[model samples]
Target: MDVIIARHCVAAGEDGLSPLQRDLIEHPARIRIAEAPTGAGKSYAFQRALRDRGHRILFIVPTRRLAQNLANGLSNDLQDAGWSRQKAAQSVAIWSSDQTAVLRSQGVASINGVRLLQMTDLGSFDGGMIVATPEVVSGLLIRRRVEAGQAGEGVFDMLEQFDHIVFDEFHSIEARGFGLAALFARLATVQLDNRVGFGVSRISFLSATPLDLKPTLVDIGIPEEAIALLRERIVPDGRPLHGDVRLSLVDSPSLYDLVLDHLNEVVEELAAGRQVVIVYNRLVDLEKDLPALSRKLPEAGIDPARVLVINSVRDSTAKGRHQGGFAIGRQRDPLAYDLILATASVEMGVTFRNADFMLMEPGFEAMSFLQRYGRAARRGANGRVIVRIEEQRKPWLRAVVDWVRERPGERSTIAALTQVLSRSVQAEFSPHNTASTFGQLSSQAKWCTALYWSVLLEHASNRQPRRGHLLAHQPKGAGAFYRLEQRVRQLADEPGLTEQVNHWLKLFHAQAFDLRTIEPKIRVVSDTGEAYDYPRVWLQRETEVFERGIETGDEIHIQGGLDDYWREDKDRHAKRDWICHFPHTTRTLRLPCDERLVNRWCDELEDIDPYEFDWEDHPQALEAVQKLVRLTGLVPGHDPEISLDAVSGVL
Candidate 1:
């Protein structure tokens, strides 16, 4: 199949307005869902619709980096529209965890002159723009509810103050099990019910590749008719908003090897003065292959300064090596670089207007795949995309490849392409699966809900008022909140358990109910005295390699010994231990800094029983045992023969 799709010259509409821009201006709805192609000006349209209306806008994105980018853009838009620079800066604020920390400590952190504000500041913030991640907004809502012991009236009032709430990249909401999508649905339902009069905030969801979210919204008690779904029409006679992307699919077992195979091609592109972007799925792979790429690029007479690396890692010391890698939150013009290497961090919200070619690993989901591709060929310049797929790992890529092949020489609009890719990964991208994932709360979400509701009930006393709010639409009685309430009550009775529960509650609330177990990270000092933090799990995996290197008398970049560093000062060790243990509640046991002790603790953590816990069967027992572990600082039963009942007395 030829990757190139024939382009046709088409004239823009007489009014030069996209369908979304026209709808926002002429036929505004309370709940609007817009699906448009990348660079179609969806965000700009939404901004323009709300501009001069004196409407308080809450623009929610998936990541903090995107929030920063959008906040900067919005501030600039306000300035371009005739607002003074200082006034525009003051109007556009960022509300994210990092910004929250800064605000709490220093009252403000400026991003491109825009003030970063706290959740408490929202009440007094008048008719301005606030950019945030869903986690930050949802966490604020949940935290307010638990703390105030009511229906979170303070947070709700703050939300009501916003004239419009826009969720950008809204497709990300369908993340499985207690994700922002599900949490937002519940929050939106509650807010809709609680709002009594006019001046309610309009909710708009914007996505380049949108999922069918109407069913999920309706399932969670949102009115079906209230939603206004607007899809961009593929105007055969109209010019494409984005550049025509020529895609090439490559199946390989190793993405690194595949990139190496195409090194000469990359060099050729760079030598031809074309901007190139290479995206890796894993940071480890990027780190490993970067040195080789750097060496070869310089040898090919390409200036080393032209190469730019962007990843999650922030290494100020590596400026001389990679021309100062672009870390998250650090602004740079990506188009300035002749060659770029990045991870998934650059996939969304970041655009490379002048990028002529791209070599990328296939993303896990279809949305991510499209998002990665969308980064290039922007600004109406034709670009080439080469996707390296590990078919054994991502078998869905084969289906997508076959689908494209079956329709050889076909010209597809962005909407049509989205449909084909989404269908290829139906289980993940389908509406049914999205609804199912949203309906079912994870155990951690259930635990948090039960705890919060129990606190709310303590103050409200009447259950009827609380009904139809807070995941009430789910089957089996308001998300089994009552069933889990007893467990929460029992655990609260345990000594110090209330404090522990509150700590965990705050942590989970801040994380937006995401309770994925994260490995403790420790800063490792390299032989060159450069320090970098690595997860304990990664270090554990590398231990064998380190030991084998030591036996063979080979020099290793990372020294296995860390006792000296830990022993340098007692306060240092204490602080490091606190940092490592802060994110966790009951997932692991705390141990001293001895290497042997760390290994033993890791083994013990692995050996602990999972309890086969179901929300319906053992809600009480699971909560009890989890609380017991937190209180006792010990796993209930390390031995397989011991029953959970045997540890009930410990609680």
Candidate 2:
């Protein structure tokens, strides 16, 4: 549908645009690249664009969690504000990733209407912000949805009518595939298919750490000056729920013990302050020891109400088949639990409006650490993030961790990934890494591979994004080359080469510090079937407290030791203990549902000896069930007449 053909296409009523929204309208970019921090009121930019006279708008992201959250948020905000013309029953639709043809034939799979889509269904929404993952957008532009006949709408045509496209978590783009994001940025800068192609009227990229995307931005066409002006200074944190984040270096310390100690402190604080608490990124290198991880929390005086654990695996599950938000989503509540432990999932889509404290592992992944840190310090409340690491992991950690950390140099992973994606866009193509690497991949596989490639490729490049650093003495008339040379010379004259690198390193560090890598926002919706008064679960993060913290100016780097007995002691109970509540893949039970809808509910309980599926409830099958139950357990007088014992004699 064309913008001219809309049932109503007039900018009507008073939708007073915010200051930033005004900037979006005034300086609308042919290749506009805009970035604002978490609380900087970024959503206003899109709301302004909603008034555009375009046939459609496309909103892209890196994760399904983000897509769902944005869908719900946009719909809720729109309805509450009365811009929503949707029928009550058709308020909005959450497009799931499980809409297979089989499910569609059953009338449950669909892509139209207000939707939540995987990276492959970007074409469903012809003229609205079709919230999607980068993978889906990439597929829309670079590949076909399915083969011919087994057809669906192609985003190719749909991409044309878009007035402006938005990439919210631009920095945390897919590691395995960010073809859509990079392509969008690259084309947002240059026009290929007239306005229909990549320009999409105007493209805006957003993220907490928008700096990490500087190279990609410049490569696209965002003026270096604008990039600087948009991302000026790091906003000082609001008051933290936790005290000053104390990042400490623990050499060869037990990772479990350190986390346990940290968790204990948060629990204590929650109990005392009666505050909801949160722990960010607790799954890294801690999942194994994390199960027994909580056994000692009670010893530290923490209650379950004071703790809520979340991570990425749950996001994967909720992507399909599951509709709960416990594992992932932005949870902000002042009156819920007392402690909140989380992975990167809390940053995008979810807003932490009341949190004010955070504990983070220390490393050079500055933007990420900051985003997680920002979760606590919203609503003008003070907040802090303490980045810590086991000192023992430093040597190997620096080798492994630092290798993958985003840097400011041209050759860094962020740059390379951007360039490769940019070139793919220029050529209008996407990668085939999945088909080549196809296998039963653990959910972690995509991220690990993308991380490794970023380290390996970007570290070898020479491109660099312009940072807000200048030379001590350089003529105003000097070109970029002369200024850069002068700056390098002055730095060379510093105390050491390290000090010289320090200048650029400072800006580079700031870039990484501001990269917007994030876990997709999640919704922890609890299902109650058809019951109206069931206990409801909204994503409300409990506050947490940690002991001993790092002052703002403390050495913001973490050193660790790795020469310890890192064991992978696998145990049976370990499966569900520390990790996510992943359904048992190896087990399957068949349940019949209404023919129109087939739902699989896994009652993992294999069989209860005391009770049977129908041993007593259905007398016909009672004898056979009783006989089978006897092999497992035996009892006397209380036993049914068709008991396996008596059935043995009958046989």
Count of residue pairs whose backbone atoms collide, per candidate = 0, 62
Superposition error at 505 for model 2 (Å): 41
C-alpha TM-scores of all predictions:
0.69, 0.47
lDDT values of the candidates? 0.54, 0.37
How well does model 1 score by local distance difference test?
Answer: 0.54
Give model 2's TM-score versus the native structure. Answer: 0.47
Off by over 4 Å in 2: 1-18, 47-56, 82-128, 145-156, 174-178, 185-200, 211-229, 232-285, 293-306, 319-338, 347-350, 392-651
lDDT of candidate 1 over 1-651, digit per residue (tens): 436533322244565666666675455466777776666777766566545555577788776667766777877787888888877776777777667666567754332122213333432433577887765665444332232233334334544576667788766653222233433334444434546223456677787766666655555445666678876665555655656777777777666677677778777877777778888887666765665666666676667677767765532222324322322223444556787788887766766647768889877766677778877766567777888867464555666687667776566656556666666555544445432121222233333433333333333322354333433434222344454334544544555556644444333223223322234454555555554445544444433323332322222345533321222222232211211121123443444433343244434432443452223444554554344233212221222222323322221
Candidate 1: worst-modelled 10 consecutive residues by lDDT: 575-584
**Native-to-model Cα distance after best TM-score fit, residue 335 in candidate 2, in Å:** 10
